[model samples]
Target: MQHLDDSTRTELEAAAFRRLLHHLDEHKEVQNIELMILADFCRNCLSKWLVAAAEERGETLDYETAREYVYGMPYSEWKSLYQAEATPEQQAAFEARQAAKQEKGQ
Candidate 1:
Protein backbone atom coordinates (compact mmCIF):
# COMPACT_ATOMS: atom_id res chain seq x y z
CA MET A 1 0.00 0.00 0.00
CA GLN A 2 1.18 3.52 -0.64
CA HIS A 3 2.25 5.60 2.32
CA LEU A 4 -0.55 7.51 4.02
CA ASP A 5 0.20 10.20 6.57
CA ASP A 6 -0.69 9.14 10.09
CA SER A 7 -3.97 11.07 10.24
CA THR A 8 -5.22 9.88 6.84
CA ARG A 9 -4.32 6.28 7.62
CA THR A 10 -6.13 6.49 10.93
CA GLU A 11 -9.24 7.99 9.33
CA LEU A 12 -9.33 5.31 6.66
CA GLU A 13 -8.92 2.57 9.21
CA ALA A 14 -11.73 3.98 11.36
CA ALA A 15 -14.00 4.23 8.34
CA ALA A 16 -13.25 0.65 7.43
CA PHE A 17 -14.11 -0.43 10.93
CA ARG A 18 -17.43 1.40 10.82
CA ARG A 19 -18.24 -0.24 7.50
CA LEU A 20 -17.51 -3.66 8.93
CA LEU A 21 -19.66 -2.95 11.95
CA HIS A 22 -22.48 -1.79 9.71
CA HIS A 23 -22.22 -4.96 7.68
CA LEU A 24 -22.37 -7.06 10.82
CA ASP A 25 -25.44 -5.17 11.98
CA GLU A 26 -27.14 -5.66 8.63
CA HIS A 27 -26.36 -9.37 8.65
CA LYS A 28 -28.40 -10.14 11.75
CA GLU A 29 -29.01 -13.71 10.65
CA VAL A 30 -25.33 -14.45 11.28
CA GLN A 31 -25.29 -15.47 14.90
CA ASN A 32 -22.30 -14.81 17.14
CA ILE A 33 -21.85 -18.49 17.97
CA GLU A 34 -21.71 -19.27 14.26
CA LEU A 35 -18.99 -16.68 13.95
CA MET A 36 -17.12 -18.25 16.86
CA ILE A 37 -17.42 -21.82 15.66
CA LEU A 38 -16.43 -20.80 12.12
CA ALA A 39 -14.18 -17.74 12.46
CA ASP A 40 -12.97 -17.99 16.08
CA PHE A 41 -14.32 -14.55 16.85
CA CYS A 42 -17.69 -12.87 17.46
CA ARG A 43 -19.46 -9.63 18.33
CA ASN A 44 -18.60 -9.86 22.02
CA CYS A 45 -14.97 -10.38 21.15
CA LEU A 46 -15.03 -7.31 18.97
CA SER A 47 -16.61 -5.27 21.74
CA LYS A 48 -14.00 -6.44 24.22
CA TRP A 49 -11.24 -5.46 21.84
CA LEU A 50 -12.85 -2.08 21.30
CA VAL A 51 -12.78 -1.39 24.99
CA ALA A 52 -9.19 -2.60 25.20
CA ALA A 53 -8.16 -0.29 22.37
CA ALA A 54 -9.80 2.69 24.06
CA GLU A 55 -8.01 1.85 27.29
CA GLU A 56 -4.71 1.57 25.47
CA ARG A 57 -5.29 5.11 24.20
CA GLY A 58 -6.06 6.38 27.75
CA GLU A 59 -9.77 6.84 26.94
CA THR A 60 -12.23 5.58 29.52
CA LEU A 61 -15.10 3.51 28.08
CA ASP A 62 -17.62 1.24 29.70
CA TYR A 63 -18.38 -2.20 28.33
CA GLU A 64 -21.97 -1.39 27.30
CA THR A 65 -20.96 1.58 25.18
CA ALA A 66 -18.29 -0.42 23.45
CA ARG A 67 -20.78 -3.20 22.89
CA GLU A 68 -23.34 -0.83 21.44
CA TYR A 69 -20.76 0.51 19.06
CA VAL A 70 -20.03 -2.98 17.86
CA TYR A 71 -23.61 -4.25 17.78
CA GLY A 72 -25.20 -1.08 16.45
CA MET A 73 -27.85 -1.62 19.13
CA PRO A 74 -28.33 -3.15 22.54
CA TYR A 75 -26.99 -6.64 23.08
CA SER A 76 -30.45 -7.90 24.04
CA GLU A 77 -31.95 -6.57 20.81
CA TRP A 78 -29.21 -8.19 18.76
CA LYS A 79 -29.82 -11.45 20.55
CA SER A 80 -33.52 -11.33 19.82
CA LEU A 81 -32.94 -10.54 16.17
CA TYR A 82 -29.95 -12.69 15.37
CA GLN A 83 -29.42 -15.37 17.98
CA ALA A 84 -30.73 -18.87 17.41
CA GLU A 85 -30.82 -22.10 19.36
CA ALA A 86 -27.94 -24.42 18.58
CA THR A 87 -28.83 -27.66 16.85
CA PRO A 88 -27.80 -30.99 18.37
CA GLU A 89 -25.05 -31.29 15.82
CA GLN A 90 -23.81 -27.84 16.68
CA GLN A 91 -23.87 -28.68 20.36
CA ALA A 92 -21.92 -31.88 19.82
CA ALA A 93 -19.34 -30.09 17.75
CA PHE A 94 -19.06 -27.35 20.35
CA GLU A 95 -18.53 -29.91 23.09
CA ALA A 96 -15.89 -31.74 21.10
CA ARG A 97 -14.09 -28.51 20.40
CA GLN A 98 -14.22 -27.55 24.05
CA ALA A 99 -12.81 -30.90 25.07
CA ALA A 100 -9.97 -30.54 22.62
CA LYS A 101 -9.22 -27.04 23.85
CA GLN A 102 -9.21 -28.25 27.43
CA GLU A 103 -6.77 -30.98 26.51
CA LYS A 104 -4.57 -28.31 24.95
CA GLY A 105 -4.99 -26.07 28.06
CA GLN A 106 -6.31 -23.29 25.87
Candidate 2:
Protein backbone atom coordinates (compact mmCIF):
# COMPACT_ATOMS: atom_id res chain seq x y z
CA MET A 1 0.00 0.00 0.00
CA GLN A 2 1.11 3.60 -0.55
CA HIS A 3 1.05 4.20 3.19
CA LEU A 4 3.48 1.39 3.99
CA ASP A 5 7.20 2.12 4.30
CA ASP A 6 9.50 0.52 1.72
CA SER A 7 11.03 -1.99 4.14
CA THR A 8 7.63 -3.01 5.51
CA ARG A 9 6.22 -3.42 2.04
CA THR A 10 9.17 -5.51 0.94
CA GLU A 11 8.86 -7.69 4.02
CA LEU A 12 5.17 -8.18 3.46
CA GLU A 13 5.72 -9.02 -0.18
CA ALA A 14 8.40 -11.55 0.70
CA ALA A 15 6.11 -13.10 3.31
CA ALA A 16 3.32 -13.35 0.75
CA PHE A 17 5.63 -15.00 -1.75
CA ARG A 18 6.65 -17.53 0.87
CA ARG A 19 3.04 -18.23 1.67
CA LEU A 20 2.30 -18.70 -2.03
CA LEU A 21 5.09 -21.23 -2.34
CA HIS A 22 3.77 -23.04 0.73
CA HIS A 23 0.29 -23.07 -0.76
CA LEU A 24 1.57 -24.46 -4.04
CA ASP A 25 3.46 -27.14 -2.17
CA GLU A 26 0.34 -28.09 -0.28
CA HIS A 27 -1.47 -28.50 -3.61
CA LYS A 28 1.07 -30.76 -5.25
CA GLU A 29 -1.61 -32.35 -7.37
CA VAL A 30 -1.94 -29.12 -9.34
CA GLN A 31 0.27 -29.48 -12.38
CA ASN A 32 2.30 -26.74 -13.98
CA ILE A 33 0.49 -27.08 -17.31
CA GLU A 34 -2.83 -26.59 -15.50
CA LEU A 35 -1.45 -23.49 -13.87
CA MET A 36 -0.16 -22.14 -17.17
CA ILE A 37 -3.49 -22.79 -18.84
CA LEU A 38 -5.49 -21.16 -16.04
CA ALA A 39 -3.16 -18.43 -14.71
CA ASP A 40 -0.53 -17.89 -17.44
CA PHE A 41 2.25 -18.55 -14.97
CA CYS A 42 3.55 -21.46 -12.97
CA ARG A 43 6.36 -22.44 -10.61
CA ASN A 44 8.79 -22.72 -13.51
CA CYS A 45 7.76 -19.26 -14.59
CA LEU A 46 8.49 -18.02 -11.08
CA SER A 47 11.90 -19.67 -11.25
CA LYS A 48 12.68 -17.95 -14.54
CA TRP A 49 11.54 -14.64 -13.11
CA LEU A 50 13.78 -15.17 -10.10
CA VAL A 51 16.74 -15.76 -12.38
CA ALA A 52 15.86 -12.68 -14.42
CA ALA A 53 15.67 -10.56 -11.26
CA ALA A 54 19.06 -11.83 -10.14
CA GLU A 55 20.49 -10.97 -13.56
CA GLU A 56 19.04 -7.47 -13.31
CA ARG A 57 20.76 -7.10 -9.94
CA GLY A 58 24.11 -8.14 -11.54
CA GLU A 59 24.00 -11.54 -9.89
CA THR A 60 24.09 -14.96 -11.55
CA LEU A 61 21.26 -17.31 -10.68
CA ASP A 62 20.89 -20.45 -12.73
CA TYR A 63 17.52 -21.84 -13.77
CA GLU A 64 17.97 -25.20 -12.06
CA THR A 65 18.81 -23.59 -8.73
CA ALA A 66 15.96 -21.15 -9.02
CA ARG A 67 13.63 -24.01 -9.92
CA GLU A 68 14.83 -25.99 -6.90
CA TYR A 69 14.06 -23.01 -4.73
CA VAL A 70 10.54 -22.81 -6.07
CA TYR A 71 10.04 -26.56 -6.17
CA GLY A 72 11.37 -27.28 -2.63
CA MET A 73 13.54 -29.98 -4.23
CA PRO A 74 15.28 -30.65 -7.51
CA TYR A 75 12.79 -30.19 -10.32
CA SER A 76 13.38 -33.68 -11.63
CA GLU A 77 12.39 -35.04 -8.23
CA TRP A 78 9.31 -32.88 -8.14
CA LYS A 79 8.33 -33.97 -11.65
CA SER A 80 8.73 -37.60 -10.81
CA LEU A 81 6.82 -37.20 -7.59
CA TYR A 82 3.90 -35.02 -8.58
CA GLN A 83 3.82 -33.94 -12.20
CA ALA A 84 1.35 -35.75 -14.43
CA GLU A 85 0.97 -36.19 -18.15
CA ALA A 86 -1.67 -33.94 -19.61
CA THR A 87 -4.60 -35.71 -21.19
CA PRO A 88 -5.31 -35.20 -24.86
CA GLU A 89 -8.20 -32.84 -24.07
CA GLN A 90 -6.12 -30.86 -21.61
CA GLN A 91 -3.35 -30.52 -24.18
CA ALA A 92 -5.82 -29.35 -26.80
CA ALA A 93 -7.27 -26.76 -24.47
CA PHE A 94 -3.82 -25.55 -23.53
CA GLU A 95 -2.88 -25.16 -27.16
CA ALA A 96 -6.03 -23.18 -27.87
CA ARG A 97 -5.43 -20.93 -24.89
CA GLN A 98 -1.85 -20.31 -25.98
CA ALA A 99 -2.96 -19.52 -29.52
CA ALA A 100 -5.56 -17.08 -28.22
CA LYS A 101 -2.94 -15.32 -26.12
CA GLN A 102 -0.64 -15.10 -29.12
CA GLU A 103 -3.42 -13.71 -31.30
CA LYS A 104 -4.13 -11.08 -28.65
CA GLY A 105 -0.40 -10.27 -28.40
CA GLN A 106 -0.37 -11.13 -24.74
Candidate that scores best on TM-score:
2
Tens-digit lDDT string for candidate 1 (1-106)? 3588889998998999899889988888887777777766889999999999989999998899989889888888877877899888877777777788889998
Badly placed stretches (over 4 Å) of model 2 are none
Candidate 1 regions off by >4 Å?
96-106
Let me know the TM-score candidate 2 reaches against the reference structure: 0.96
lDDT score, residue 2, model 2?
90
**Cα lDDT tens digits for candidate 2, 19-97:** 9999999999999989988998999999999999999999999999999999999999999999999988889989999
What TM-score quantifies how close candidate 1 is to the native fold?
Answer: 0.82
Candidate 2 residue 44 Cα shift, in angstroms, is: 0.3
Candidate 2's displacement at residue 77, Å, is 0.6
Give the distance in Å from residue 38's predicted Cα in candidate 1 to where it truly belongs.
1.4
